[model samples]
Target chain A: MSRSDNAFNQYLDLVRDNAAVMAKGRPALLEAVNKAGASRLAEAIEAYKPASDEIPECRLDRLFAPDYGVNIARVPMTADVAASFRCGVPQLNSLLAVVANDIFRPTDVLMRNMPEGLTVCSLRQVPAEFEADAAALLADGADKNSIAGAISDALAHDGIYVRVAPRTEIEKAVQIVNIFNSPVPMLTPRRLLVHACEGSKVKILLCDHTQTPAVQHLNLQNVYIRVDAGAEVEFYDIEESSAATHRLFSFRAVQHSDSRLTVNTDFLSGGVTRNEFDISVPGDGAYTSLSGLAIVSDEQICSDSVVLRHLGSHCTSRQIFKNALFDKGRGAFGGRIVVDEAARFTDAAQTNRNILESPSARMEASPQLEIYCDEVKCSHGATTGQLDERALFYMQARGIPRDEAKRMLTQAFMVDVIDNISFEVLRQRLHILVEKRLSGASADCSTCATACHSQAPEE
Target chain B: MEDLLKVENLRAGIDGKEILRGINLTVRPGEVHAIMGPNGSGKSTLSGVLAGDPRFTVLGGSATLAGVDLLGLSPEDRSHEGLFLSFQYPVEIPGVTMVNFMRAAINAKRKYLGLEPMSAADFLKTMRQKRAVVELDNKLASRSVNEGFSGGEKKRNEIFQMAMLEPRVAILDETDSGLDIDALRIVAGGVNKLKTDQNATIVITHYQRLLDYIKPDFVHILYKGRIVHTGGPELALELEEKGYDWIKQEVDNEQI
Candidate 1:
C-alpha cells in the first residue's frame, strides 16, 4: 500500500478501537450507528486527519477523546425527551425545523409551508430517491481534514440536509436548535449541509443550548454551505453552553458568481470554546461578510479564527470581530484575508477589537492579509484596550454610580456588533442578554438551555 | 445671609508640586465670587480640589458646604451634596443618550436625599424645562453626551445640566473662554436665571467680559497659589485693563 493508504488505514484502526472502547455497556448506540450506515463511513474516516495545530490548547483535552466515558446505553432516547426538546425550540415563525437532543442524535425534523422544489429532511430519513444524492453531497461538501469534519464523519449519527429550488425565496428564517441533556461526560459530533440554488434566498438561525450547567460534554459541529450564482444567504450561529461544556464549531462556505453570503456568530457562554469560519469567493462579483461577538468571563476561554479568500476578480469581503473579556477570562481572534493573483479589483477589509475589563483579563488578536493582485483595496486592523477613563469620569461626574458607568461604557462598546442583526426581536433579546452577561448576572445560569426549558411547556 | 461655602488655607497640588499654596475664601448664599488670574495661577486647581478630583493631592485644606465637610466625600457624594462644576473641556461620552444620563444623575441625587426615583414623565418634564433655560436644541438633548457637539453647545449643555441638578453651589470654570458674543450672552443669561438667594455661584474667568453679563459680588486676583487681592467687581475690570503686571508690582512692593 502507498504511504497515503497506510495513513488512512492507521486512522481507521484508531476509530475502530475508540468505538469499541466507547461502546462499553452501550450496545444500542453502536447498533444505531451501524443501522444508519455510519459504520461504512468510519472506514473512510482514515482518509481525514485532525488539524490539531489549527487550534490552541484548551486545557480540557479529555473532552476531545473518543472514549470520554459516556455510555450511550444509559442515555434514554425516549419519546419524552424528544418532546421536551421540541418544546424548547424558539417561538420563531419558520418553515424548516431541526431539533437535536444529544450528541449526534436528532430528535425531530419538520418542513412546513416550504416553497416548491425544496427538500428538507434528516440524514437518516432521506427518501430513497434522494438518498444517493444526499450521501454524495455530505461526502463532497466539507473538508474532511479539519478536526470538526473528521470527527463528524466518524461519529455523527444524523444531521439536516436542505436544498432550495432555483428562483425560490424563503421569507422566514429556518431555525435549528441543538439541546444537550447528558448527565455524564459525552462527545457529540453534528453536521449541517445547505445548498442554495441559483437566484435563491434563505435565512438560517442555528442555536445551541444545554439542559443543565453541570454536564461535562464535548460538542463538535461543522456546517457546509454552497451559494449558487445570484443566490443570497444569511446564517447566524448562537452558542450558549454550560461551564462544563467544550464546544468546537467550524463553518465553511463557497460562493459562486454574483452570490452573496453573510454569517454572524454570537458566542455567549462556554468553558473552552473555539469557532472557525472559512469562506472562498471563486466567482466574480461575489460578496461575503462575517461578523462575530464573544462575551466570556470567569475562567472561560473563547477563540475565533476566520479566513476569507478572494479567488476571482471583482469580489468583495468584510469581517469584524469584537470580544469582551472580564475577570480571568481569555479571548483570541485570528483573521486572515487573501487576494489571489486573478482577484483584481478586490475590496477586502478586516477589523478585530477587544475590551479588557479587569487587569487579569487577557486578549490576543492577530489580523493578516495576503495580496497577490495589484489592483486591490485591502486593509486590516486589530486593537485591544481598556475602557476610557475620561468617559468613565464623565459619567460619574453626572452622578451615575461608578459601576453603572462602567457597564454603560462596556455595553456601548458592544452595541456596534449587536445592532447589526437584521431581525428586530432577536436584536432586542440579544441586547438584554449581552447587558446581563456584561454585568455578571448570568454567571449562575451557565446553561441558557435550562432557562429556555423553564419557559417550555411541560408535557 | 448664611455662609454656603468656606475655604480656609486650602493647599493642593498635582505630582507633589504645590499649586494652591494657601488660599482662603468664603461665600454666602446669593453671592457670586469671581477668581481672575493669569495662566498657571492655580485657578483651575481650586475648582479641581472642590470637585474631589483624585488627580490633585490636598496637602492642607478645609472646605465646607453648609457646615458639612466636603473634603471627606467622594466626587459623586459631593455632587449629591449640591455641588456642580461646569467643566472647562467637557468629556465626550459616546453611546450614552442624554435622557438616560440625566435620569441616572437625578435618581442618584434623589436616592441620596432618601426620596423615591422620579417617574419618567416627571423626569422628561424636568428635562424639557431645564433644556429651554440654556436654549439647547431638542436634537442635541437626545444625542450622546457632548458627543459631536460644538464648543458652544458643550458649554450650554453644562449650564443645562447645572439647571437640571439645581445645586446649592455651582462653579463655572472658563465657561466664557470659547464663546462668541451670542453664545456668551446665552450662557451667562442661563447662569443668571438659575441663581437664587438660597444658592451661590463661583465664576472663574480671566476676562471681565463675562462679569458684564453676570455681576460678581467679589472679584479676587489669584497669583502664585494665593489670593493677593480681593475687591468688588471693579477689581476684574481693573485687572483686565492694567493686566497682571500691576498686581505683581504691588505684591513686590508690599514684600519690600
Candidate 2:
C-alpha cells in the first residue's frame, strides 16, 4: 500500500477504536464526521490542495493522530500544585490574581476551579440553555470540511460553555487554562463556545501550556464565539507549549449589530502551530479587529490563515500580524477580506509584517481583498525584511550596545500590536514576556517556575 | 591647557571615494571651535569619522579624545571615551521613550566608568534638570525618542542629551540647519550654559548666524576636505560676509 493510503487507513482505524465517542455524539455531527472522513480518504488518494493556496501547503500527514493512550482522567490538583499553578512568573501571578480561572488538565476539567458563568463538562453533558448553540456551532464547523475541524468534532470529548448575561459587564477577565502533561505521545482536543448576550461586555484569556518538554503531543482546539447586538468581547489567546508539541486551532466568530470583537493571538514559543480564523460581521455598525504576534526560534513553525467577511453595511474589520523568526524558524500569514455586495460603506484593512533574524529563517505573507461593493474601502499590505540596520547603528551610537539595541527595536516593532490590548495589566505582562523571549530567556511557563524560584534573590 | 580633541592628518572616505584629505585640527578645554565651509566640503564627513560611523572608512588618520585612541573603539566605546556627535539628521526610534533612551545612555556611560546605575528618582531628577536647560517640554521628554518630533524639537533634544552625557568633547553638526532665530538662540544658549572649563564644543555650521550667539575662540574654513585657512572668531564673520567665494578662489588658486 502507498504511504498516503496507509496513513488514511491508520486514521480510520484510530477513529474506529474510539467508536464509543462517535456513538455518543449527535447524529448530525456523526454524519458530518463520516462524510468528512470519506473526503479525507479521497483527498489522501488524490493529494488534495491545501486549505489556503496562498500559504505553504499544510502537511496533513504530520497531523495524523497517534494511537497512544491519552491522560483523560483528571489529575488530582494537590494543594501544592494549585498554589504554584501560576508558574511562579511574577507578571502571570499578578495578572492571575484578578482574573477568574477555569483550569483544564489535558481534557479533564478541574471542577473546583470553575468560575461563575462557565460550564465545563463532557460534550454530551452541556447545559440545556447552551446545548443547541453548541450543537449548531459544531454542525456548522463540520460543514466547513477542514481536517482539523472534522477531527475536533469527531474526537473532542470535553467542551467549555460560557454565557455572558445581558447588560452585565465582566470587570475581570475569565481565563481558560489548558494544561498538557503526559509522559508519552498523545492527542488532546477540546471545544470552547462563548455567547455574549445583548449589551454584555466580557474579556477572555486562553492560555495553552505544557508541563513537560521532552514528550510529544498534539493539542487540537476549537473556539466558537457569538456576539449579540451592542455586545462587546475581547479574547486573548496565548500559546507557550514545548518543542515536542504541536498546536492546531480553529476559531470562528459571528457578530450582530453594533457589536465589537477584538482577538489577539500571541505565539511566544511552540514547536508547530497552525491557526485558522473565520470571522463574520453580519450586522451593521459592527467592528472587528484581529491582531497576532509570533516570536519563534529554532525549527519552530507558525502559520495563520484568516478570513474576515463583511456581510452587512457600515461594518469594519482590521487585521495586523507580526512575526520575528530566528535560526531556521518559518512563518506564514494568509489573510483575506471579503466584502459582500450588500456590505456598502465597509472599511477593511489588513497588514502582515515579518522580520527574519537569520538568513535561514523564512516567512511568507499574502494579504488579499475581495470586494464586490463599490463604496467599500479596502487595503492590504504584506512585507518581509530584516531588522533595520540604520536604527541599530543609531542606538549603538547613543552608547547602547548592539544586542540591546536590537532587542529594543524588536520590542518596538511588536509594541503596536500589544498596545491595542484593552487590558492594561495584560498588555504590560506581554511586554515583559516579549522582552524575555527576545533576550533568549526561556519563556516556557513550566521552566520559568523553577528558574524564578532558584533566582529569587530576596527569597 | 591640554587639548581635549586632537586630530592629525585625518583622511577618510565612503565607498572608495575620498572625502576628508589630510585634515588637522585641535581644540583645548573651555574653547568653542567653529568649523565653517560651503556644501560638499566634508564637514559632516569629518564629524562622522570622528564619531566612528561605519559607513565612512578611515583611510589614514589618528584621532584622540582625552588621550584615548578614538578610531580603534566601537561607536559606543567612542561615546564612553567622552566623544559625542549630534547627528546632522537625527534618527527617530519609535516606541523607545526618550526617558528610557536617556537612562540607558547614562547607565552605559556610568558602567564604563565603574559606577553604579542611577536610581530611578535620581535619573528622573537629572532628566528634569537637563530638560530645563534646553527648555524642552515635559511631554516631549516622555514620548518616544524623536518620533513625531519637529526639526527644532529634535535639535533641542540633541542638546538636552549632550547636557545629560556631559561629554568631554561635543560635536554639534548643523544644529542650526532647521532652527528659527528664536530656536537658534535657545539652542546656542543651551550650549553656552553646558560649557565648562573641563569640556569643549565644536560647532559645525554653514552660516555664521549661530556663531553670533555662541562665540567661537577659533574658526577654521574647510575647503575640499582640507582646512585651508585658520583664524580667530573674526574668520567666521569674514566668510559669512564674503559668502565663501573669496576663500574658494584662494584655495583653488593655491591648488593650481
Docking class of 1: medium
lDDT of 1 by residue, A80-148 (tens): 444444433354555535344443333333433665767776665666766665666676555554534
lDDT of 2 by residue, A141-228 (tens): 4425565565555454455666777877766566666666566676776667788889988888887766657887777778888899
Model 2: which residue pairs collide? none
Candidate 1 Cα errors over 4 Å, as ranges: A1-56, A59-82, A85-98, A103-118, A128-133, A443-459, B252-256
**Candidate that would win on TM-score:** 2
The local lDDT score (0 to 100) that residue A285 gets in candidate 2 is 94
Interface RMSD of 2: 1.0
- DockQ for each numbered candidate: 0.68, 0.71
Per-residue C-alpha lDDT of model 1 across residues B12-126, encoded as one tens digit per residue? 9999899999999999999999999989999999998998877899999799999899999878888888889999999888877888888889998899899999999999999
